[model samples]
Target chain A: MSTLTPTVPAKPARGLRSTEGKAPRAQRESPFARVSAMIVMGVFTLYFLVPIWWLLVAASKNRSQFNSTNPLWFADFSLFENMGNLIAYRDGVYLKWMLNSAVYAGGGALVGTIIAGMCGYALAKYNFPGRELIFNVVLGGVLVPATALALPLFLIFSQISLTNTFWSVFLPSLVSPFGVYLARIYASASVPDELIEAARLDGAGELRTFFTVSVRMMVPALVTVFLFQFVAIWNNFFLPLIMLRDETLFPVTLGLYAWNSQVNQIPVLRDYVLIGALLSIIPLIIIFLLLQRFWRNGLSAGSVK
Target chain B: MQIKKRAAAVALLTAATVVLTGCASGSTTSGGDAAACEPSEGKVDLTFTTWIPGMEDVAAVWNEENPDVQVKVQTGPNGNGGTYQNFFNQLKAGNAPDLGQIEYDALPNFRVQDGLMDLAACEGVLDAKADFVDWTWGQVNFGEEDAVYAVPQDAGPMAMFYRADLFAANNIAIPTTWEEFAVAAEAVRATGGYITNFSQSDINQFAGFVWQAGGSWFENDGENWTIDLASPESVKVADYWQDLIDRDLVSTNPPWTDEWNNAYNTGSNWTWNSAAWGANSIASGAPDTSGNWSVALSPQWAAGDNAAGNWGGSSTAVFKGSKHPYEAAQFALWLNTSDEALTMLNKSANLYPAAKSGLELPALKEGVEFYGGQAIYDVFAEASDHVSPDFIWGPTMTQVYNDTSDGFKGAVTGNGTLTDALTSAQQSTIDALEAQSIPVNK
Candidate 1:
């Protein structure tokens, strides 16, 4: 396996024209091609960003101003006040949900990533009887939707007295077959067998050689797997909704959903729900942006192999 | 060496999944013999799930009064179909709350699942039965055996909440009859406004109109159900609203949503034919319209016909899961009949009371500032009396409500006439009932 050169160029606008300029004269495209592409990209960016922009603005408005004022822009600058109320509501229940979410997503993704990475690395770098069979099974697990598993998983957890606890959600979320598949492909591409042999020759234990040499090469793949599992665990609603009853154990997404259901009865909670939605995404955005460098390399590496 | 580890991990993964998936337990609460309530140490911890706003305070009163049984109030989804779905899910999981807040319309759906306990067996529940309104009493005493499935909590007897300022500005006299309402609808449209937002999605709203027009949809003698959904009275109700839809005098937005909020916020729909709870819901959605709104008795079929309809209200029902039926029924009765509980419920929930006692509560008597300081509940109180008793819902009210709502969608979108929708909805109801082996008298 070899490194896959990233298909998305460093600058698409420049790359499209520069790559084309090298071709024959008759094949040359119109001058407006790049401009039109840029326009299309700009329109898509706006289309995607506008709702988030509106949410950010909506979070700042009070209950009265939410519907009465301009929808896409800020009015009363009540973001702080609303956030304060959201935190203070039901005696800081929102913060508890946020903590629960952090525990479920962060801890689950970390554990899932380690297992997935190790498993993927083994599948990609090693060959044994029934290897393809195992790979195919893991791929099948990836295709079986999480929602379909939620109730059955709940019943399983209930039998074991874990349904209402954090473990119910955390345990199911930790099995990321897709994560393992990514790790396997990434490991084959990045971590050379020769490096492992060299480490082995130095008399390093199998575990030691794998940790010191292979794990370092697998960092980008591991982070991508972790982020994938993290977002899935964070946004998970049905699993938590069906499994947990104690409000104290709820994730932010489920908590917001519960609040939103009562919005018509308590209109004031609408502001809190909007603000909570805005704030819940900020952490995910920050994490994604922070790890994007690793993600790009890992994605390209996976594709190339 | 790595090959061995790969094979080991795959085997382990497969083994783990097998164990996890294999652990799928038996279907929840399969044996009908859920053990009778054994109050340990004469103290039972009960979980009551409800969507009623301010239910916690009522629970607190129950807790304070009865130290022997601790009540934990869990919030369920709102009464608009979500609560029923949640109830069904919990019931399936065999972990439903001991007491579930069920709507009069949705009660039968839970009953059909054998999820509810017959309250007749619970001590003292029958004595407290006389405390609720006659119509509300009829709702609880469901099925052919005349069994009480639930105790009424709050009600939503319908009324026309009008914008007095808009009507006065237009020189439109208060509409006392359906013809006058149509005239006012046209007057409002003349001013580039709508009289009301006829939500194609709110089946409860349409049902309320039918109730006022003297249509039951279903009737039972504790044995066989007679479903007459397309009764002439109901057809008349549908035709009247259909005429309004054709005239474009009403906006066909879905209710209790952002789009409907926008219509009210902009004064597009100057009137609301809603339940007593509409005042609180309106206060939440369009607080700026306060002091401009007022309540009138819902417009009539005939000039002197004083019948009314109900849209949303719920009852506290004892699930078959209750370990202590006596205590559960006691809690349900107290939540409805206790003076402290009733006052707190009305104050916090803003639900029109199904209990006759709630009509006299000071909290309910207070003028709602949102309706321009009108004691608007008086109209709803009168409307509650007018709510035609003996109007029984079929076991498939949820499916029927949805089917009828879909009909409204057809009418609104020009795919079918309102009369066609009624005919289709009635046929669907009869077909669905017959499929379920319930008797359907078309």
Candidate 2:
């Protein structure tokens, strides 16, 4: 595990230099290849970023200007006004959706990560009968899509009279098999047996050793798991769509979708949907940027092993 | 580790079994028998789900006045987007809202599924029948004896919204008949503008066209459903539009899209034949053209004819399992029939109320600034009066709309004619009805 730590920092720098160094060689070998690569990357970058740019521009325009003015450019700087209207519309329901999204994503991810972490650590540290069977099941769970489970989950929740409650959506979100798989892989690769034995030799309980000693070593993995689960839960629409009928409990994704559908009836909601969509993705971008270093490290760590 | 693995495995296995069993046992509960519509004892709380804009404010008014029967309003997407699907799921789960906003075309679907309460037994429900327009009243009853399934909420009487300035500037006379409308389309195209943008996805609009032509797409004779999607009258209407599309006299932009809005806003499209609610659609979609628009009666198939089509309208229905049907019916009647509530709804959602008295509201009389100071609702009122009361909706309107819309999209792209779309859609509608176990005439 100690030997693994040094390679994490050194590998990124070497990787960065290797990419940078390839640029010169690429130019020297064939300008056409270099130019083509740059062109391809440029096209992909535009393909990915242009819709976001259009959303930003559209969110800044009033309803009149949305169709009358340039679609890809701003006019009259009505972003604040549009945002105020969106916030004030339906008595600040947009903000409620934003808050609900935070609770579902933030709360769901944190709790889901811990459960996944503990379960993964146990599988990695323990020599258990049926461990492979359990891991295989977890792997199978990862293969099952969330959309496929939404209807059955609705039925199960409905049987207990939990449909339309916050718990109906939150409870289903907690079981992230992908997070469990990631945690196990990272735990086995990074958390050494010697360190656990050493911690145990000091009379530490298994839980204490796992939390204090092993968890410190698993920061990158846990952060990756948290961010993954957060984004997944944040973007989840079908589960909440079926599980909850209460608009106040809706996540921003479902809320925006509802508004988008009503634009024909409430045409002004078009502007609100545009601005809401732009605002919805801001938190995702912020979270990604904040946890990017750990995410990158976690990805590299898994790949190297 | 062995204990933890066993624990995790047990948890996973249990969850999987529960889900599997849940799926296997997800048999739908048959709708309850007609309940005695009795007032609940003590204070009653009810849930009403609707997608209407400003419905919260309207419900708040109701809640303030009637504390004993407080309503919790949940707003979502329009019916057919996701809300209808949610309603069906909630109905299966036995947790549907006490009342839900169901469109007229969709009411039969819910009725066939046995999801609605027979409000005729409710206090004052049948008595309130005189409050709504005749057609709207008939819509709620589905021509059934002593069974009012819903209270009509709004009506969408069809009319033509045109650019007065564009028509004037080009020295083109506004068309009053279908033949003249065709000629006007040619003239408008000569001026480098489409007479109207034909919607490729809004099969409901196409249905409205057929409705105005004195054609009925569905008829239920109390035993079997009859689907006449390609009846001669319907084919005549379709061929007329098909000619406009073929000759490029109309732009085939998909409705509710930016391109469609741009066509209206930029005056590349000169007219739209839409429902009463479409006034707001034009005002919001083409703000730049606000002061230049005017409303006229929808063009006649024969000159001097007064037939008008109806498009979108909805009803407030008490679900089958609602405990407070008595209170639900009272609220629904008040919401639809009362002048105060109707005016509020008109201002909030541009709702053309199904109540006959709603046509005479002060708001309906005033000249709207957006439509060149025209008293547009006057036109809609006349259209509402002319809307045929016999246009029966089938039990699978969603399926019909979807199948027809897909075919219409193909027609617009030259894959087929509009009549061909109607023909295929006719077969599809029958198939859908038969698949749903609803008896259908071939």
Best by lDDT: 2
lDDT by residue (A1-305, candidate 2, tens digit) is 12233334544554665666665553343446545755776677788889999999999988888888888988989899889999998899999999999999999999999999999888888998999999999989999999989977887888999988999999988988988888998999999999999999999999899889999999999999999899999999999888877889999999998888878877888888999999999999999989988988887776776
Encode model 2's per-residue lDDT on B188-218: one tens digit a residue.
9998889998888888888899999999898
TM-score values for chain B across all models: 0.86, 0.91
- Model 1 CAPRI quality: acceptable
Clash pairs for candidate 2: none
Show the lowest summed lDDT stretch of 10 residues, model 1 chain B: B24-33
Estimate TM-scores for all models.
Answer: 0.88, 0.91
Worst lDDT 10-window in candidate 2 chain B? B24-33
Best by DockQ: 2
**Candidate 2 runs further than 4 Å off:** A1-35, A303-305, B1-35
Interface RMSD values for all candidates: 2.8, 1.4
| Prediction 2 TM-score vs. true | 0.91
